[model samples]
Target: MLKEFREFISRGNVIDLAVGIIIGAAFTGIVNSLVNDVLMPPLGFIMGGIDFSSYFINLSGGDYASLKAAQDAGATTINYGLFVNAVIKFFIVSVSVFILVKQVNRLHRREQAKPSAPPAQEVLLREIRDLLRDGAPPRVIPAADSRTV
Candidate 1:
């Protein structure tokens, strides 16, 4: 059982998954920073200095100046503003992942579309085989024409 577990951990898929998970955790931090530090400030300014993080409904009867104030006062509040920020962050991460996946897929398609050339020895062997199969040697076309036999 221990050997099987070691084998599973050593597999390419498991290692790839571990790397992907670590990268994703790091990416989440970057996305959070982007949303909190970069995107939200300008967006808030555009919305007439409205801080989305402060937009919450007070469940507790106490009226507070801000979300932080309400929370500090032990008030039960619906933190919809924070939820909005979370949604925006989610979209940013989603679009980033989608674009990354799309580019990777495009590169894969390009690699698949390209025809790989056979080695010189293989090409020579194929030509010799053809020559032996027919009574005459294989006819060679000029370079201007397609070089394929």
Candidate 2:
């Protein structure tokens, strides 16, 4: 069982999967930061400084200045601002992955489009066959000349 486990762990596919998982985790962090820090700020600024992070629907019949304040006051609230941020993050990740897959597919198609050379033996045989077909004439060994050699 241990040997089988070792073999499974040593496989190239397993290593590639591990590396991909680590990279994906790091990429998620970057996309989250981009959505929350970079994109949202400018978007909020353009929309009359309306901070989306504080936009929430109070369900407890009391007005609160911010989401935190509402939560602190034990108010039931629908945190739509956080939901908006999540949606933006999902969109960015989706577009990025789509573009990446598209480029990878393009590269794969280019590789498939390239013509590969034939094997050396096949090429040599083709050349010899062509020579026999078009470049050579049949040698006529006259019956009378056969005895002279």
Best by TM-score: 2
lDDT for 114 in candidate 1 is 98
Cα lDDT of model 2 by residue, 23-102, tens digit: 99999999988987899999999998977878899999998888999999999999999899889989998999999999
Question: Where is model 2 more than 4 Å wrong at Cα?
Answer: 119-125, 137-149
- Could you estimate the TM-score for every candidate? 0.76, 0.77
Q: CA lDDT of each candidate? A: 0.94, 0.92
How displaced is residue 85 in candidate 1, in Å? 0.5
Instruction: Pick the lDDT winner.
Output: 1
Q: What is the C-alpha RMSD of each candidate to the true structure, in Å?
A: 9.7, 6.4
Cα distance off (Å), candidate 2, residue 71:
2.3
Error of 2 at 2 (Å): 2.0
Clashing pairs for model 2 are none
